[model samples]
Structure formats: C-alpha cells, structure tokens
Target: MPHVNTTIIIGAGIAGVHAAESLRNEGYQGQIMLMDRDSQMPYDRPPLSKEWMKEESDNANILLRNPAIYEKLDIDLKLGVEVTGIDSQRKTLDTKDGSSYEWEKIILATGTSLRTLALVGDDLRGIFYLRKMDDAVAIRDHMQHVKQAVIIGAGFIGAELASTLSEMGIDVTIVERSSYPMENIVGRQASAYFLDLHKRHGVQVITEDAVTQFHGEGKVEEAITAEGRRIPCQAVMIGVGVIPNTEVSVSQLEIDQGYVVNAYGETSVSDIYAAGDCTSWPYQGASIHIEHWDHAVNHAKTVAKNIIHPQSAPYTYTPYFWSDQYHVRFQYFGHAKEWSKTVLRGSAETDAFTIFYLDAQDIVQAAFLANQPKHALPARRLIQQQKPIDTQALADVNIALKKVPRLQGESNTSV
Candidate 1:
C-alpha cells in the first residue's frame, strides 16, 4: 500500500465517520480528519424524519459514534468547518472560514440537499424543508404548537413524516404530484397500498395535486393547489426530492448531475473519491445513485478500501431501502425501474405481503414488502448473484421462499 500521510474527508455524516473507522480497521495509521459544515457531531440522517423530529432530545441517539470512539480511534474531528473549494492539482481544500488544508487523498461525502419547489409563496413563514438536524428541530418545535401539517411530495420521507405527525395527534395532509405516493421508487401498485395505509392512519392523502402556490399573511396559512383548491394548514413540509451536493467549484472533476464514479468509487480526478448520496456509481445491473442510509455506510466502506487498494473490488451493491410508517415496515431490495410483470407472493390488503417485479426473462429485478423482511433476504441474494429462480414457486404464498432452488451454474451477470 502506498503511504498515505493525511486523509481528509468532507462532511462528517455516515460516510465520513464510517470511512475513518474502516481505514483504522485496515491498519491505516495516518492522520484522519472528518469535517462537517454543521456544528454537531457526525450523526445518522435517518432519524431526522422519525425520532429526532419527534423528541428534541433524541438527537443524542443519532451520533455515528460516541465522543470516546473518536478519541480512542485518534480521528481528528473538525465540526462546523465548511469546505468551500477543492483544488485537485494542489491536493488541498479551502474552507469557507478562510482556511486551507492539504490532503494526500480526499473523500467527498457531502450528501444531497432538499430540492424545494419554486412556488409563488415559498418564502412564507412556516414553510419548511427537512434534510438536516436543524431542520428537524424547527419542524418538531413547530409541530408542538401547530395542529395541522400539510406535507408536499409524498415520497418516503414525506410519508414517514406524515405518519409521525399523525401519531402525535396532529392532522396531516399529504399532497403528491404523482398519481400515487412512492411511485418513483416502489411502483404505482405498491404505492397504492401506502396510500391506503396513510388513509387508515387518518392522514388525508391528496394524490395528483400539485401545489401551484402558498398563501398566507406573515406565515403559511394555506396551500393553493393547481385545481384552485385551498388547503388550510399552519405549516408546510416540502419533501419534493433531493439533488446531489456537487457544487460548481468541483465541476472540472467531471460530474453528471452527481460525482460520477466507477465501481471503485473513483472520481475523474486521481485520489479523489465520492460516496453516499453525492456519488453516482455502477451497481449490480445499472449505474445508480442511492440515497438510502445503508448505501451511505456501505459505499463509504468501498471508498475507504479503494483509497488503500486502488484496484478495489467491483461495487456490486444491492439496492435496498426501508421506511417506518405508522405500524408498517416497508422494505425493498434490488432495482425496479418499470416492471413488465408484477407478482405478489403474499397479500397486500392484509398488510403483510411481498410484491415481486419481474422482467420478461422471469428474473426478479426487485421485491417490495411490508412487515416481511425475511422474504427480502433471499431476493437480495438472488439479485446480488444475478440468479434466476422458478417463477411458480416465487409467486406462491403458501410455499416457503427459501425452499425455492436456484438455477445453478448460470453465468448471467445481469440481475
């Protein structure tokens, strides 16, 4: 291994913290520093939508590692430091506070930011977007006084937050521009169950309703829909979507909306790697950029290994995502862009079932389920190996999913 003098990682989120830990595990005795623009310690971003947003004190649980771990591991933690620019040729970074640091290698773990809608009254008070700890705190505080919360964009985050607010005795309304919530990720059918779930939980779900503008005096009192319907609410939670945090300063390094990386997390600039939501890399069947929590941790591991071993293993990652909404635990594995055939292994109406998306070849491309994570295990393995299974056995709910035999010795690389 080439000697690395100093390794500096930007953004002390899951990716940065895990990369530092992985390096130490691999016997790297170099100076490791994690920098975050936020003042808090490295923390898990998932809880921002659930626990952290409900109870203010719950932020303690989100820390990636306790303070002792950083001291014990000898990681130089630099919180509240923002990297304003990256100089690839000089192998150095400039911070917003007029400071510069040189690094032997740099890992960009700066995750995505929330993409707010450009509505007419977007600047109105009580209009919020949740993506950071600060955002969560503000939302939580406002929820304590507000009786109703209207969430725009019915994605996972939006849905989860709506469920959370509903559980707290707050009236919640979710407006989705799509025909159904989570259609982009979970497909329209699975998203339909999600809609039913929300309705059962007393959440008013308005699908295919686009918010044209917000209306209020000094604060957001109501949302004006495209169809000219005004929904009354004290606050608006915008969860439209996210965009990669690659800024113009690093544009020369090569980017296709995100920092384009190979299977090894290598950017166009040598010794520069990116992981987490900021990275777009090749996975099992296609090039994808996943924003799930696990991807941030796992991809950071690959980036760390690649930094030490340039010829890193191919990042054949299985796309996985989960959401905690009401009493349902929705989990998905593998990629499902658009399924030609949809098969259900169990029942969705009963709320405990798995949905399988298969291509014309009958190979399972993706699987979705609520409260049935065990079924996801085999599907994940099959997707990783790119193996084909018996379709009849897969679709039978009475049959044990694991009992299905794999077509051995098939050398198909696509899953």
Candidate 2:
C-alpha cells in the first residue's frame, strides 16, 4: 500500500465518494482523486424519484455527505471532470478537460446510463429521464404547470414517479410494454400487489402497451400507444431500465454486462479495478452485475479495503434494495432470478407481507418484504446462511424467520 502513489476514482456518485471515504478509513495514504462529469456535489439517488420529486429540496439536504467532509478527508473532489481515456500499461488517465494524471491505481464506479425512448417524440421538450439530481430538479419545476403526466414503464422509477405525481393531483397514466411489469423481480403473485397499489392510488396503468409516437408541436402534448390508445400529457418521464456505463478506452478490459472484476474488485488489467453497477463480480461462483444503493456502498468499501490491503476482504454480502411508492415502502433482500415457488408470509391484502423465493431444495435464495420490519433482519440472516427452509413454518406468521430453519414440519401453514 505504501508504494501506491495515487488512486483515481471515476464517477462521484454513492460508490465513488464512499470508495474515497473508505480508502481513508482503511488507512490508504495515496492521493485519492474522485471525479465525475456531473457538476453537482455528491447526492443520494433513490430520493430523486420519490422524496426529491414529491417535494421541494433546495439541493441542500439531498447531499450524500456534508460539503466540509470531502475537504476534511483530503479527497480531491473533481465535480465536472470527465475521464476520457485510460492507459492501463502506463497507469495514467486522460480527461475531457485536457488533463492527464498518473495513477498507481484506478477504480471505476461509473454506475449506469439511464435508458431512454427512441420514439417519434424523443426530441420533445417535456420528455425526461430521472437519473441525476438536475433531472429531478427540472422535473419538479415543470410539474408545477403540468396537469397530466404519462410515465413509460412500470419499473421502480416509473411506478414511484406515478405515485408521486398522482398524489400531487396531476393526472398520471403509466404505459408499460409488459403485460405484468416487474414480474421478473416480484413474480406474478406479488406483481398483482403492485398493480393494485397503483390502481388504488388512481393511477391509470395501461399494461402490455408501449408508446409508439409522441404528438406535439415543440413540446409533448400527447402519447400514442401501440395498442391504438391516445393519451394527453403535459410531461413525460421514462424509466425503462439502465445499462452499465463502461466507457473507458482500454480495449483489453474484460466486459460482460459490466466491467469484469474479481471478488476483490480487481479488473483484468493490473492496477485497475471497478466496483458498483459498472462491475460484474464473481458472486456464488457466478458473475453478476448488481445496480443498487446498498450493493454500491458495500462493494465500494470492500474495494477500498482491498486497495489498502489486497485480498484482505471480499465482497460477499447479500444483495438488497428498497423502493418507496405512495405511503408504502418495500424492502427486498438477496437475489433470486428463478425460484421453485414464492412462499408468502402474512397477507398482501393487509398491506404487509414477506415473500421468500426458495429453490427446489427449499433453500432461501431471496426474500421480499413489504412493510415487514420484524422479518427484515431474520430474512437477511436466513438468506445469507442459505439454509433449507420449512415453507409452512416460514410462511406461518407464528413462526419467526430465524426459527423456521430449525423447525421443519410437513403440516400446512396459514397466515
């Protein structure tokens, strides 16, 4: 670590800043230059669609850390600097500002690029995407004069925006291309819960439909769906999805869905590493790219730890993320793309429940909790342990999550 002269971190979002802070905490004496293309100070992103959009945040309280803290940590915070190229062999970086810097190590925390629409109204004035702080600010300002809004997609961002805009008394309509949006994340049984939540909030959700055309003069006035539906809207926000932002000029750097990295966040090129959403690291013997706040924070810390002392720690934490829509908040723990079946605890009807995604062997792969605070810790622990679960006991509200692994019975359990 003493030989390490400088550590250049790209992208100053949650991952980059935390990586800098974690480097200091891990006793890395090297010069840490944190850079981002964004001019704004580092801010949390989850609130951008929910809290920041719903209310007026004067760019003060939205900060991820206080302004003084960056100075205190001696992290050279470069807000508007964008790295254009990376010379891995020479260990130097070229920036868009015509600046070149020599670095012993580099960490890529570039995050993801927000997915945008390519329809006829793509150039419309009122069309927007929510990814950065400034995007939310613009949307918030325009919302004052907007009477109707059409949100495309039913993912976390789109759904959250629909809820916030609808609560503000603006007519909100969501056009999702999938018959059941978010089915891949929450499964079909729980997917119905989300639709009902939006419907109850008076959000006109049009499923299995995609916006094909945008009709307007200079600004957007109406959206034409693939299903021959015409909807009038003053503003449009798209939340389709995002792809990894891997734009480094290095040709040899391995990339599969994201910048390929090891468990210790070491990239293919020596002295170069990557973390957060831009990295695909080995997890449970499979390479996976996770784009979530919790993953970014924890992965950055682990990368920092390894940079300070190589192979000292590995990122093995269970994946987790949360979404806030309307008055309800949903917290999901672990990751399960496919499961044998979803074991439900409590009732989705009662607005509180936990869905466990178990494999064929009845092992806990992941769990979804809707306003279930008591089960959060236990569910996380169970998922981490990867122990065989008793479906009946797990689903039974009487049996605690921690105890479900211990007591396995064939008896049918009811909420």
Candidate 3:
C-alpha cells in the first residue's frame, strides 16, 4: 500500500519496452528500471527469422528507441542481466549475479521459449532452432553450403523459414507432426492453401508424421520418422511451439498455462502485473493467452495505464493478428470458437478475400482476410461492439465495409 516510486520490469523485449513507454505516456513519473537477459538493446524479434536470414547485415537492425529517448523518459535500462527470483512479500528481486533490488510494484513480461523436440541426435552439430538473431545468422550461414534441410514442426516459424529457404534455392522438407500445417490455427481450409503454396514453391510438405530419432553420427544428416521413413537432409529446425517463461514460484500469483489476469492485466497479488506471452488476458469473457506481437504491445499499454491511473477506463479491445507469408498477408480478428456461420466477401482463388464468422444472431465473432486489410479495421470495430449486421449486406462483395448499415440490436453485448 506504500506509494509506488520505483517500478522494475523484467525482460527488455517488446512488452517490457512498450510498458515503460506506456507508463510515461500515462503520466507515471517514477523510476523505471528495465532489464534483459540479452546483451544488446531491445530489438524486434519477428524479423529475425525472415529479413535477418536474408542478409547477415540485417541482424544489427534491432527494434529499439532512440538512446536519447531513454534519458528524456528517465528510464534505467539494465542489459545482459537475468532475474533469478522474486520476493513478493518484500517486493524485491534477486538477480542471477547475487544482487537484489526492491520495488513498490513489478511487471513480468518474460515472454516464451521455443519448445524443443525430444529425440536422439537432437544435440547434433547441424540441428538448429531459429528463435534469436544469433540462431538466424547461424542458420543462414549453414544454408550457404547445406543443400537440403528437414524442418521439424510446421507452425508459423517453421513454415516461414521453409518459405525463406525455398526462395534461397534450398530444398526444404517440412515434417509436421500434425495432419496439416496450421490446421490447429486457421483450420483445415487454410492449411490446404498453405500445402499447395509450399508445394508450388518447390518445398515438400509431410503430414501426420513424427520424428522417432535424428540420424547422424556427428552432424544431423537425416530425420527418421516413426513410420520408418527417412528424410535425408543436412540441417534440422524445430518449431513445434513455445512455452510460457514463468519459472518463479509465487503462491499468491494465479497461473493457468500462463499468469492468469483479469481485463486490467492485474494479478491476484497486489502491485504485481503481467503481460505479453506470459500472461493470460481476459478475452470474450474468458481468460485467453495470446502470443501475437500486437497483443503484447496492446497488453503492455493497458497494464501501464492501469498501473499509473487505475481510474482511466476499462481495458478492452478486439483481438487482431496478422502474418506475412510469401506474397500474401493474412489478418484475423476476434474469437471464433463457437461461431456458427462462415461467410466470404471476396474471391479466395484470387488470393484477395475475407471470411466472416457470425453467430446465430448474425453477430460478427471473428473475421479473417487475405491481402485485404481495409475490411479488418471495420470488422474489428463491429466485433468490439458486438454489433449485429444484415447477413446479405455484409456478404455482398460489391458493398464497401463502411457503407454497410450500422448494426442495430437491443441485445448486443457490451464490449
């Protein structure tokens, strides 16, 4: 209950940095200390596996604020330091180097880690997982001499890397454990589209496959599947998924798959907050954990506002996400777990389209679009308002998104 003056934030990635900025924007003129395990300034991680792999020089392009901005904002950044433990009672943290710091409030934005494949030969020389800038640089260098690569898992990272390698003239084979790539995400239809995209781009896509063991003497040379099939390759990149980075055991903190928090990003423990991939945020009246870049930024701002001025407003926003693959940009918003209808507004064959998921009452629950971003803005607005729209008007391909009549319903849910 003491006055909060110094706020220490762990992890200097997107969430941490943005939270600091948000705190300043919210008029929190306090002592802000940002720490990171990495030795460099906070840089963008999303581009590491894409543009960074194309040119080694791109590795230096880290997402950061101007150095003068830190001084202007009065933020003390501690790079290359690891937080060992959190003493919630004393409101202090122990650093890995046997140092400690106290704070009136704290925020944990530790993020997540790439899930490693459990198989023999996993520690071989040519086995790799692209999660950091160093990993991408190493993989790009290896690709120069490696003619073939067997990528384990076909999630976003694996699929994007496969596309990048294929563009570089490298023969890439994606060995996915699931029935289809991204089937668990955008559903079977989208997965089929990706399958054809990869195949047309000269990349082999394997499905319903599990790697029994990696076959190599001193270096990774092949991946042996459970079906006795051998995929010959020189390098292996595993992108199964990621796990939340929450190791500190605090009994007062609620945690499900991640740190459970309410709409305001508040934890059960007072003065303690969480955001980014490590926090489970309230969405659609339920706690939903998102690992998207936009969620991290938006959550940081919300947590910052709540921390600085708790009386500002409710933390509410529609969930929106996007990913750039090949020449197409896929964007999605809102939740679709219980939606009953899926309508298309544009032609999927032309690679320019939008899919809207509507509930039984004609309320838009979610909308996904490929290459068409204009509809997403309005779709997000409708979802946030829980607005009911005319089915025919929304489905009409010729009607402009804004031109559609405003949703009218006395039973619309409050955002």
Error of 1 at 311 (Å): 1.5
Per candidate, the number of residue pairs that clash is: 0, 0, 2
Q: TM per model?
A: 0.94, 0.96, 0.94
Best by lDDT: 2
lDDT of 2 by residue, 1-415 (tens): 2235699999999899899999998788879999999998999988888777777565677898999998999999998998899887777789998998889989999999987768987898899999888788889989999999999999988988998899889999999988888899889977889999999989999998899999999999999998899999999999999999998749889999999999899998887889899989876667887799999999999999999898889778788898888878899988778889889999988899999898777877888889888888998887777656678888888876677754353321110
Query: Each model's C-alpha lDDT?
Result: 0.82, 0.87, 0.81
For residues 1-415, write the lDDT of model 1, one tens digit per residue: 3235688888788888998899888777888988888998877878888877767447668888998999899889999898888887777788889998888888888888888779898898898998887887788878878888899988888988998899889899999888876676777778889889999999999887788998889889999899887899999999988998887246568787678898888898888888888888886546777788888888899888888888666676787888998788988898767777877887887899888887666677888888997887877876665566777888887778878766644544663
Q: What is the C-alpha RMSD, rounded to one decimal, of candidate 1?
A: 2.2
Instruction: Tell me the spans in candidate 2 whose CA falls farther than 4 Å from its real position.
Output: 1-4, 407-415
Determine the C-alpha RMSD for candidate 3 after optimal superposition of all C-alphas.
2.1
**TM-score-superior candidate, 1 or 3:** 1
Tell me the tens digit of each residue's lDDT in model 3 across 224-251: 9988889898988888899988885477
